[model samples]
Target chain A: MRSKIGLLVVFTIIFIIPTLNYAFAAGDEPGEYLDRRVVIWNLFFRMMVVAFTIGAVVSGTMVWLVWRFRESNPNAKPTKYEETGEW
Target chain B: MSEHGNWAEWVYIGVVCALLVWVGAEAWNVERLVEHVPADAEVIKVTGQQWFWSFEHEDGTKEIGELHVEKGKAYKFEVTSKDVIHSFNIHDYVVLIDAVPGRINIVWFVPDEVGEHEIQCREYCGLLHYNMRAKLYVEEST
Candidate 1:
């Protein structure tokens, strides 16, 4: 479930959002070319979304990892690599 | 780790890397397209003084606190500074470029809307930096 959610985050941030941004840009009616208002505005918004998305995902992952693997976690299980120092 | 799990991890990494590479290429292309100035773009010389912005048109007309441009026409601003480093910004049009001493920086934009906009120096130059502002008039073409 965790990995699935992480993958979903990655896919949305890396793929879906940018594709939507382009779709909106491509739909513009022909009149002005290279309007900085649109270009810079879109770029700023897309980057802001990507940055916040990535930051949230990474922070969530770190929090989850800490909560699941901390020394106080009762459900923590030692894997083969952790037990015998070999994988 | 199990062999299948190891393979899955590797494949996942490979897919992510491929997607990242694709995104990077797309961003590079878009940046180039945005910064590319066409041959017919009108050039306007922009000088960044210590406390004000100045513009010079091709016809030798000059303005200190105001710039008039035609709507729908692409304009290329060749920016430079006289005393210190400054940043030229037309916030309404999102045209921002560094005005460095001894070097000319370039930024271009097409004014789609005909109206009054704001232009300001984004860098700290002197005591009067806060008052360094101008009006951008995008007049309709005759």
Candidate 2:
């Protein structure tokens, strides 16, 4: 849909476009690192950020799903395995 | 494609694709940054022997167990080994490259700090592998 495409474009412009420069940002920063060390450190920091974010997202999702789909939750629907009692 | 609805599937695919693209781009950037040697970089030959590191500067100045370089200058190291495999690592500058027999590996770094840093072999070579080490002195450019 046009609305979906528009939203994607807007999201990319606001978020993705700004970060595109990071790919070429392996240069002198205001610190002890100014060369290859800076590039490697940036990579490590970025990877850790992504790792921690993904870890939190997965853990939070698992906790919410477990609580929402517990057997004690009356609103939880019975899975086909539960109905068949075979799994 | 579990029949997990339409919009959810598309959004999931888009997010995964975006993440992959970003990771790939970052990887390529790092590769370029590490591999692209500067034209003005000073070449230094780093030789890894049984249990010692030797350096040969561009002016043919040789130093054993000690490498003297200037601060704020880019240096390209042509690393190789005389015996078994070894790893040339200068942890202060995050420079790590393999030293394989019959093969030369290239790595470069620009030292911003003018001080003495420890260099060591990260790979096990021989009985004295633990003692295989050197010192890197980054002197201020005169």
> Judged by DockQ, which candidate is best?
2
The TM-score values for the models, in the order shown, are 0.69, 0.75
Worst 10 residues of 1 chain B by lDDT: B1-10
- Top-TM-score candidate index: 2
Q: Global lDDT of each model?
A: 0.84, 0.87
Per-residue error for A33 in candidate 2, Å, reads 13
Show pairs that collide, candidate 1.
none
Residues B17-123 of candidate 1 have per-residue lDDT tens digits of 98577567656656656777766788899999979999999889999999999998988899999999999999888889989999999888888888999899899
Q: lDDT score, residue A2, model 1?
A: 100
Per-residue lDDT value at B118 in model 2: 94
Candidate 1, B-chain TM: 0.86
Residue pair clashes in candidate 2: none
Share of the reference A-B contacts seen in candidate 2: 0.36
Q: Evaluated with lDDT, which candidate comes out highest? A: 2
Q: Which stretches of model 1 miss by more than 4 angstroms?
A: A1-32, A71-87, B1-16
Error of 2 at B16 (Å): 1.9
DockQ of each: 0.18, 0.23
